[model samples]
Target: MAELVRVAALTGYFPTMQGLGADPRPMLRECGLSPELLANPEQLISARATMRLLERSAEVTGCTTLGLRMSEERALANLGVASLLIAHQPTLRLALQALTEFRNRINSTLALQIETFGEEIVLREHFALSSPEPHRQSSDLALGVLARFCAAVLGDGWTPLSVCFAHERPSPSEMAVYRRLFRCTIEFDSEFNGLVIAEADLDRSAARADSALASHARELISSVMSPAMRTASQEVEQMIMLLLPSGRATIQYCAESMGSTVRTLQRMLDADGTSFSDLLNRARMQLSSQYLANPRTRITDVAGMLGYGSIGAYTRWHSQMFGISPRQWRASAARRQPQSSAF
Candidate 1:
């Protein structure tokens, strides 16, 4: 089963209906999706489904620049938490870090890796678990998003130093749009997928990077990242930190919700030198300490939230794991906080 990618949720950024042509329903239908689903702001579709639709639209419309068209519709808020980090960071380095770290919160299958050279920054795309065809389409979509992001960030003055693709040579018209959008040299059939931008240009400072704007942008992006990466393992762990109140936490339900088969998912996790069990235990331990320290949630409710069938089960597990009872742990945590003045 394919996981819902929540592309429609992203319409907060790219909600243009024009140039989409009459009866866009056929395009959604071709992609194995419903046209009605596109109207729902809260709806999500599978990455594979969206890619298939994009490819079909490209072929049907004879427009290889369809990716670019979609990206051009993006509103800055749609980039989510990424927008906040990008807006406030003192330098491009921090901005890229926030992006790389939180990318799964925006799009799970798409990974952005940034390498800084003498005067240029290389942004590479690593697509997750995709077939060759969708992989290519993913790269195209990634490039389009990056181009649009940079354009928005830099405003009218911004242009990529150069653009490169891994696909076959683009046609004259496609190349023209690429050039027009990027306003710089566009190269196709390159070794990797990324944009080359001068370091100096990235630091030039945008007109919209004020502190107030950065703060509001941060809040908006954080909300977007939370939902978008809800199905993402790392982000899910982050969510579990807040969701978990006590005891043992499991990854089974999380994996199922993300639409991943257990064994195959475990294999991919192993490739990352980790396991689902490890992540679950780590999350449990981290959240247990935090919840125990907080006075707001009751002990029983905390245990229940952690999926414990009974208080006894949670207490036993806590004692075995940390050699301390839950009450003792909470007492210790309370002692660490500053005391309130009764006078």
Candidate 2:
């Protein structure tokens, strides 16, 4: 689950760049991005890659407000399944609540928090990532998209009382874009990145809200959220991933987590052309490679994370899977990376 995001997270990027007279392919390739990989709305891409793509594209295209420009084109349908649920929510408050719960369906690392200070309410946008280096682009993208979401749910004329960002102030040209996009008092180098508005605004009911549709959509989104209906194997793999660090990546644990019995889980996995042991081992091998590639990670620490109780046992399993000791594998991985990226 290493902070992956669905490709729909970039729902408005392609058209935005094309309209701006920029060919995004070269920028994407330089950042190790593939346009074809984004064709499938349900396909997962590295959140890090998404962040890097935005930063590099902005730098290459000389668009200081690149992220904001892209997010302005976002629509309600860009939310995927969550759109149905959010569309019918009775009020802006409830819609944001739905977003807090279902944003994971879009980006696993995105976090939205709402807090009240007196009559003024702040809806903070932050990333729950470890050391999210170069976050300004993503932050602006999130803010613009959120403003669009609020306007879609409320009305196009609805605007926040103020929009804030922790990043330094933009250039005069960029500030003009920001003011035009937000249509509200824009504060830069603020205490945090969020939207501030009167609490009364949130309480206003949506003109087109439908309680019945919202209820049904919530049920469907909640039940189908766990598995994107991809495959039983992938479902099981994700389950094992969440349980591995807790040393509970067993068949019983995976089955229970998925609300199925061990027998039923095994049967479903078999029907999907996979076995529990094979899936678990594959997940471990993949995660091990990713973890060992980080120089700051210790082999013994990786072993514990992979559910191995002893370093010797972990080394034996590593050799069985890749025909090399973890140390040697890490060395090779380091050599393959650019000198400037060894971090």
Candidate 3:
């Protein structure tokens, strides 16, 4: 089975803003979640609960636009913190580097990575396990928010070079909408999901940048780090590493092994800012290196032990995570080995 993405603790960004003229309480209650739960930023809800909330919120608000709105809300709510890192860094590259580092503090599930390819800056989304159902919606929502957030930070005219998605082939309708929203090319069903921006855009100064503002933003993000650290979760991570070789691990199985209810296990993981799905992928990524190091292990067998349905799936995931095929990885590993000297 494909690994699940975790989104519990990260959902705390869905604040219950009383004055926003929309009562998020009824929506939360319907999903068996509470607005107060946001207070415990470490607390996590189940993927089921998160999906229900997303669907119900759309139903309640009568807005097909909730995904983008939620992304923007998250960006706006956290701008104070983001500005601190983005404002003072010596260059846009460094600012993005800091943003990538501190992204977990906001939502650990929103896996953010910055890559530079020639003149382009790519902000990739490694989706978390607990993201909303209909994975395409969640992926698109993430990309939309990121594009808007960068524009907000760098100035209104900022645009991306291209936006890419791993699933859902881009349609003309989506292309038109995406182009209108981001003013960039939208490529779907790509090898990865991320946005590509021109390198020059990073050098453009934000409308608001000053030492005092930068210092204040830094202080806020810094203060949150301690509390975030205190609540970090490692049990699921440990369990995931253990189960990767066996490849039969399920959420229920993991909970049983941990001696807890599934809900309890999920909650603990959420508090730690991760989920079973995220942990599994991470374990596979880590173990691929070890397994690939052994020439005796066939790529097919490695895929089976990792619980992949087929070697193709495993190879695709491996390439996405490590940027190389298993065959290539194994070949590279062999080349790096020191030869024995028979004196």
- What C-alpha lDDT values do all the predictions have? 0.60, 0.78, 0.60
lDDT of 2: 0.78
lDDT of 1 by residue, 1-90 (tens): 133455543351223324645345677767677756666644556777776776666666666666766666566567654666675655
Query: What are the candidates' C-alpha RMSDs?
Result: 19.4, 8.9, 14.1
Model 3, position 318, has a per-residue lDDT of: 86
Residue 14 lDDT in model 1?
Answer: 27
Q: In candidate 3, residue 257 scores what lDDT?
A: 75
Q: Find the 10 residues in a row with the least total lDDT in model 3.
A: 1-10
Best by lDDT: 2
Error of 2 at 40 (Å): 1.3
Per-model TM against the reference: 0.60, 0.65, 0.54
**Model 3: runs farther than 4 Å from truth?**
1-30, 35-48, 55-66, 72-75, 79-83, 87-90, 128-134, 169-177, 220-343
Q: Which pairs of residues collide in candidate 1?
A: 13-75, 80-221, 81-221
Tens-digit lDDT track of model 3 for 1-343: 1232234323323552332356877877887777676565345445456655765665565544445445544544443345466756645565666655555444444555565789887776643442223433455567776787677667677788887765444435434455566787777545466888887877776655566766777787776666543232444544454455456567888788767888998888786667777777766765566455556568898897677889999999989977999999888766765542000
Model 1 poorest ten-residue lDDT run: 9-18
